[model samples]
Target: MNKITKALGLSLLLSSAVSVYAQQPPKHTYKPDGYSIVTIETPEDVRFHATGLDSTSTGEVYVATRFGDVWKLAGDKWSKFAEGLHEPTGLLVDDDGSIVVAQKPEFTRLRDTDNDGQADEYSMLAGDWDFHDNYHEFTFGPVKDKAGNYYGTLNLSHGDPDAFSLGAMGSSGGYRGFAFKVNKDGEFSPYAWGLRSPAGLGSSPEGELFYTDNQGDWVPTSTFHLLQEGKFYGHPVSLAQRPGYSKESITNTAVEVFDKIREKPVALIPHLEVANSPGNPAWDTTKGQFGPFAGQIFIGDQTQSNIFRVLLDKVNGVYQGAVINFMNGFQSGNIRNEFDIKGQLWVGQTARGWGAAGGKPFGLQKVVWDGTTPFELHNIKLTKTGFTLTFTDKVDVNSVSLDSFSAQQWNYHYSGNYGSPKMNLEAVKPSKVSLSADKLTVTIDMPLTADKLVQIDFPGLKDINGRNVGVEKVYYTLNQLRK
Candidate 1:
C-alpha cells in the first residue's frame, strides 16, 4: 500500500471514537480540483505580531497587528494605514463603517471622519485613565449585533499571582470573567461575569450571546464553560456550583457587583485532559433557525490550537447546548490562537510548531470547509477485490449504496450503501477534530468501504446563515480510496 493509502487506513481506524449524536455524518462524493495553497507575504518587521481581520461590505479587508498598528489589504497590496497605538488585540467593523478595536484596558472607536474608506478619527470609548492599569479585563475585539449594540467578553484572572501575570505587570489578579455590552447610544453595561480567559465571542440564531472560557487549576478541572448573558456563571466555583458555594465560589461576591446577576454557563465538557481554553465562538444561522444560533456556536482553543462548532437548542425558549470538537491542532504556531469568521474559521497562530510548544513567530492561518475534500482514509489490506473499502462514515452494520458525486465535474462515487443515497456535505464530520475547546487532536475512526466513493456537495454547505459555499472546482481520484 502507498503511504497515502496507509495513512488513510490508519485515519479511518482512529475516527470511530468520535462523539456521535442523532445526526448522520456529512457525506462527501468528491474533492476539489485545481486547488493550490497560496501563501501571502508577511509585512516587513511583522514578527511577534498578532492579527485582527475584518472585512467591509466591499471586499476590503482590515487587519490589526499586535504592535499597535492597523493595515489594509486592498487586493494583493498591503498598506500601513494607522500607527502608534497600544497592543491592539481585536478588531471589528460596524454597520456604518465605523471600526471598534480592543487595546487592553480600553475599547477604542475609529471613524473614516472624511468620507474616505480609511479611519481618520480615533477615540477611546472607555479606560481607567492610568496608562499602567486601565485594565477592563478586555482582550478580544468587540462584535456588533444587528441591533447596533456591541458585545464581547472581558476576562480577568485570579489564581496564583505568578501564573496570572501578563505583559510586564507584577503580581496580578487572575482574569475574573466577563460579558459586557455597549449599546447603540454608546452606553456601556457589564453583564455576565466570572470568566477566566474567554478569548472568543459568538451569537446564536436567537440573538442570545455565547462565549468560550478557558479552564485552569482551581477551576474547571477538565471542561470549557459556555457564557450566557445575564448569568453570573460561578467562576471561581466551576459549574457544579448548585450545592451552595464552597471553594471557588464567585456567587458569594454577587452582592458586591453592581448588577447582582446570578446564572451559570452551560457546562460544555468534563475531564478530557484537553486544556480547555475555548476562544472565539461564531454561530451558524443558515442551516438551523433564523436569527439566534439555532443552537450552534464555533469556538477556538489556544492550548490545543483547534476550533469547534457547538449546537445550542432553544426548546420552549430555554437555551441548552452541546459542543462538537470540529477542527484539530493546526500546523501553525501557538500562543495567540483564534478562529473567528463568518464562513470558514480563520486561525491565528503565534506560538511555535503545530504542537503544544510556544514562542514562535506569529502568522494568520485559515481552515477552509471545502466540502469536496475527502477526509483521511482508514483500515486497508492489499488483498484482492481491488482493495476492500472496509471503513464507512458510520458503523450501523447496514447495507451500502452508490450515489453520484456532489461535484458533478469530478464524477466521484462511494461503495458504502448504508446511509442515504444523497450525501449531505454539510453533515461531513472531521475525522480527527478537536476534543477540548482548544487545539488538541483526537483521532476518530469513520468507517467506509473500498468500493464506495463518498459524494460531497458544495452548494449544500453554507455559512452561519443559509448562504451558499463557493469554490472553484472539485478534485477526487480512485487512487485515494485504497490503502
Candidate 2:
C-alpha cells in the first residue's frame, strides 16, 4: 500500500509541474519582424562589460571590455586574449592579424607572438596626447582607412578645476576633445578639435571617417559628424586645447564667433527622443545579406538601449539625412556594433557609471536578419521643394491620406548652456501629398527651410500585405535642399 501510494503521488506532482510550465509565456515574445536577437553567453564571474567588438576573417569574434580585458569567442568557447588595459573602448582587427585597441591612456596593438591562442605581445602604438587621470577621458577608435592611417576620438575631462569649463564638460590636457590620427609609421597628429564626449568612431564604405558624440554642455544634443580634418564641432571649451588658443582666449571669444565657424553635425540625434548617449556608427556594407538597408548607417544608444538606422544622403555636396528607429529591447547599453562576414550584427553593451535602459550591467548580443523584409522607411531624400520617402515594400495606397501625415520643424540655439531647448518650434503642414503609382514611394511638398530638424510622422500607414509600417516616424536634419 505504501509503495503504490508513493508512486501515484510522485506522478501527480510531476504532471502538475509540466502543466504550469506549459501555461507560462515564452521568453522572447516581442520578436521584431525580419530581425532576431541572439544573446551570447558570458562567464558569470566575468563582468564582460563590452565596449568594443570586431571579428577576424577566419570568423573568430573579439571583444574588448571596459574592465580592461579582451576576450575571444571561437564557436561556443570563450578565452581571454589580453588584459591590463586602462578601459579600452574600441577594438579593431587589422589585416595582418594584429589586434588594435583604444584604451584610455594609449592606442595599443596586441599580437600573438608565439602562435598561442592568447595575445602575449602588448605594444603601445600611440599615446601622444596628455592624460590627466580623469575618469571621463575616454579614447574611442582605431578604424583604419585605405591609406593605412588609424583614427580615434578623445573625450574631454569631467571634473578638473584647471580644465577650461564651459557648459558641462572641460578640457585641460593636450588634444582632449579632439580626433586624432596615427600614421603607419607610428606618427600621431590631432586631426580635428572641439569634441565633448565622442564615444564611438567608424569608417564608411567609401573610407570616410565618422563619429558619434553624446549631448552635453556646449553640444546641444547627441550628434553624428563626418570627421573632417581641422573642423570645429560646436564644443568651445575644447578650443583651449588647440595649439594657439588658451583658456583666457577661448573665454574672451563670443559664443557667436565659435558658432559661426564650427561645422554642423551631419545629423543631430535628438536628445531623449532618439538617443541620450549615442555610440558608434556601423555602416551596412553587407550588401543584401543584412536585408534591404545596404549602405545605410546603424548606431546604438547607451541610455535608450536601442539601435537606430541612419539613411544618409549627399545634398549639395554635404552629408545630411534622417534617423529612424530600428530595434530596441537589448540586454544592456549598446555601445559598439560590428558586422561579421555572415552579415550578423554583434552589439557590445555596458552600463557602468551613468547606467542604461536595459536593466543589466553588461552583455553581448547579435542581431540576425530573418530574410523577411520589414515594411518600413527605406530612405528619406530631401528634394528641392520637399521630401521623397521610399519604403522597403509596396504601400497600401488606400491606407494613406492627407490626414495620415503630420510634420513639425524646430532648430536648437547654439549656446554655452547645458543643452538648448527646441527653439521656435512650429508645425509644418504639407501643402501636397502624393503616392507614387508603384506604391513604394510617397512625395510630400512643403515649404522647405534650412538649419531645421524636421520630423514627419505617418502613423496609420500600412503595406500591401496589411502590415503596419515598423517605424512610423522619421527625424530628418534639413541642412540643405536638393537642387
Candidate 3:
C-alpha cells in the first residue's frame, strides 16, 4: 500500500476502536468500602496523563506526563517546572528538592536554580545507550539507591522496523531489554539483562533493587523480580550485551541451565487476575500509619485499574513471597504511585497508549485508608511443618477450620509461549491446624512443598472479633522447605 493509503487505514482503525471503547462499561466496576479515592484536579491546559510521581519533603508533589512536561502541585495549585522533555516514565524528587526523571532517551535531573518555581538547569545524567525509534522502545526509571546511584530499564522494541523509519528484521539496538545503573559521577553501565517491558523500578525497604516485568513472548508471567547483577531474567534477547554472550548460548541452551542461572520472581501474579500491566511498587513503611500492612509493597496495574499488596520472605538467601489483591476501581490505569509523609498514597494514572478500566483517560487520585484495620494475613513464614501465617489480629480458631480453607500447588512451564498455564496441579490437605496463644499466628500441619506455588483461599478465616478477611486469596511462592 502507498503511504497515504496506510495512514488512512491506520486512522480509520483507531477511530473505530475509540467508538467501540466508548460504548462499553469500565473494566473495574467493583468499589471496595472503607477506602476513599479522591480525584485531585490537575491543570486544565494539558492532558494530565501522568506516568511518574514523586513528592518533596515540604509536601510539594511532582509529576511527569507523557506530553513531555513536568509540573509541581502545591496546595491545589499546579506550576510548570520543566518542559520539552521526552516521554518520561518515572520521576523522583531528590533529597535536595531537585527533580530526577527517566525519559525515553536518557535519565535527567532538573533544577530550579533561581527559586523561580521553574527548572532552568537541565542536566542529562545518563545517556549514550541506544534508541531504535520504534514505538515500543520506552524507558522507565531513575529510582535511586541509598548510595545515590540512579537506575533504569530499557524496553525491547516490539515492532519490525529500524531506528530511522527504515525497514529491518530488528532495530540492531544495544541493551534494549537491559537495566542500567548511573553512578554519582554520571557513569552509566548496563547492570542486568533479559528484561522485556520492565515498567517499574524501585528499592525495597531492605535497600535491595527490584523491578516489575510484563508478560510477553519470552516472559511466562507478570513478575516482580529482585535486581541482581549478571542475571538473565528469562528473556534471551538482552543477553547480547553480556561479555562473550551469543544467541546460540541462549536459544540452544536447555531449560535447566537457564533455570539454574537466571533469577526467579519473588511473587508471580496470575494473568488478568490481579494485574495485567503492573506498575511501580511503593512500600508502606508507615508503621501502622498507613494501615496494618506496614513494610509491605503495594503495586498498581494499568490495564487492571486496581492495586495489590505483596509480602516478601527470604528462604535460603532467595526472595519469595505472596501477592494479594488489595483494592480496585481506580480512576485510570495506575502507572506510578508515591506514599506521602502522611501515609496517604498518591496514584498517577493514564490511558494514553493503553486503555484503562476506570473509564477515564487521565487523572491523579489520592488513596487513603479510613483508619479501619482490615483483617488480613500479613505474611507467610516458612516452617518445618509447612508454613505459618501471621495476621493483623488474633485468629479465632473457632472461625477457622478445614471447611474454610482449600489449597493446591501448581508450577509454570519454562518455555517461549506468551504465558504459562498452571501445570502439575496438586491438592494440599491440611493435616492439622495449630493456633498461637497470642492468636496472631496460625501454624498448619500441611507438609511443605519445595519450588511450588501454594494457592490458598481463606474464605472463612476470621479475626478474633469475627471480622471476615479482607483479602480472601493469596498465592504464596514457597521456593524452599525449611527444616
Candidate 4:
C-alpha cells in the first residue's frame, strides 16, 4: 500500500469508530444522570464470567474469564484467544500485542505464534512468590508501570464461611494478602503487605498503581489505596508475612500508634453505601469522548450492582478525596472494566457465587455518555473552612444555604471483628454557602477534622435549569486537615 492508500485507510478507520460511538448504543437506555448503559452482545459460548479486560488501539477487546479462557471481541464475534488455564482474574494487552493475565497461582502470557488469531503459547510470566490451595487465596493483578514491571495483589486464605474465625484473615502461604511486583526477567519481590482482600488493581494514566480492597475483618469499609512502596494497609493478617510486623506486634501496638503508622486509603467508600465489594476502577482519559468526567476515576461494586466516581485531591503530600454514586442497576456482579479507543466503557460482570441486585448471573455492559451534562456533584475539594463542591451544571445559588445541606461525621474502628459500624456520629451545622463566580462551584461550610469521614446531604439542590442533582449525597474522607 502506498502512503496515500495508507492515509486513506487510517482516516476511514477513525471515521468509522467515531460514527459507531456517535450513535446511541443498542439495548441500553439513557440514564437519569445523562449516561447510557448498554449490554454488548457476546458469542453464545462466551458465557463464562469475565474477571478482567483490555482493548487495543484498533478496538479489538480481549477478556480473561474466571473459568480460565481468554477471548477476543472482534467486530461482532467473540473469538477464542487462549484456553485451558487456571482461574485468571486480570488481563492486559501489551505493546507487542501479547495478552498478559493473572491467574489464581501465577501470571501468564498468551501469544499467537502463527498469526492464526488463536494463542498457541501459554507461558507463565510470573509467580515466584507464594500461593496456597485455599479457596480464598485469589491473585488479582498485573497492573503495569512505566518501567515495564508487572504487579499483582494476593488475597489471604479465608476460613469456613459459616464460622467467623480470625484465621479467615490469616495468610497461609508467603506474602499472602500482599502486593508484589515482577520484572521482565520474572523476579518477584514482595512490596506492600497488610492488605485484607485486594479485589482489583490498575494504574493511573500517570502510571501510579492503585488497588481496591473489600470490606471485611480488619477493614471497616471498601477502599481504594494508593500503592505506596513498603506500606502497610491496615490489616494485621498480612503482617504475619513481615517478620517484625507480625500479628503479635500489631496486637500489642496501641490503637493510637497503629493509626499513626498504618497507611490509609486515598478514599474510603462507605460499606453498603457506595460499594459493598468494590471491583476495578477505570479513569476517564478519553478527553471529551466520554463526557466532562475526564481524569476522575470510576469504581464498580459487585454486590450492590452499582458504580461510583471518585475525585482525588493531593494535599501535603497525602491523597484525600470524595466518592459519588454514578450509576446503579447494572446486570450481574461487576468485576472489571476498561475504556476502549472510542471512549466506550466495557464493564465485565459475574454473579456466579455472590448474588447481585441486577438479577443476572453474568453480563458484558458498556456505558456511554449521551452528550448531556447532567446536574451532578463532580468533585469535593477540601478547603480551610471545610470543602467545596463543583457541579456539572451551573447552580441556582439561591438553592444553596446554611439550611440547604446537612452533614454527619463519624470514624471507624479497626478490629478483628467482621466489620465496623459508624462510630461517634455527630451532626455538622454549616456556617455558610458561598457560590463560585462561575456558578459551577459551591463552597459549603462544615468544620472538618483529621481522620474523620463526613457524609454531606445536598438537600433540594438543583441546577439553573431546575433539574435536580442526581447524586445528592457525597462522602469525603478528610485525612489531612490542610496542605
Of the candidates shown, which would achieve the greatest TM-score relative to the real structure? 2
Find the candidate with the highest lDDT and give its number.
Answer: 2
TM-score of 1: 0.56
Predicted candidate 1 versus true structure: per-residue lDDT over 1-483, tens digit per residue: 111110111110101111111132122222222112223455777753444666665555567766666777676777776655565667776676777777665567777778665666777665421222333234665776668677766555332343223211111332234566778777876666555456666554556565665443223322234455556553443222223543334324443341234333343332122224455655543342222123345555544544444434332344433344444535333223222333433455544222232223566655454333322221222211222221112221111112111222111111111112223233323232112222111122233332222222222222222222222112121222222
lDDT of 2 by residue, 403-465 (tens): 889999999877776676788899999888889999999999888888999999998789999
Structural similarity to truth (TM-score) of each candidate: 0.56, 0.93, 0.90, 0.90
Lowest lDDT 10-mer window, candidate 1?
6-15
- Candidate 2 regions with alpha-carbon error over 4 angstroms: 1-32
Q: Once model 3 is optimally superposed onto the true structure by TM-score, how far is the C-alpha of residue 443 displaced, in angstroms?
A: 1.7
Off by over 4 Å in 3: 1-33, 162-171, 254-256
Q: Pull out the clashing pairs in model 3.
A: none
Could you tell me the lDDT of residue 319 within candidate 1? 40
Question: Per-residue CA lDDT of candidate 4, range 1-483, in tens?
Answer: 111110111100100111111212122212556588888876686666888789999999998877677889998888888876666778989879999888776787778999999987777787665655556667888788998988999987665243223533666657787899988788989989878789979899999998899877777777888998889887766666676665567567665675567888888988867777788888888997888888889888777677788889888878888888888778877888799999998898887665666778788898988887888888888888888899888999789787778999898887666667888989988888888999999898677778888999996788899988787899898888985
Off by over 4 Å in 4: 1-32, 160-167, 245-257
After superposing candidate 1, which stretches have Cα over 4 Å from the reference?
1-40, 114-118, 128-138, 157-176, 221-229, 236-264, 270-275, 285-296, 314-317, 333-342, 352-360, 373-396, 399-483
Better by lDDT, candidate 4 or 2: 2
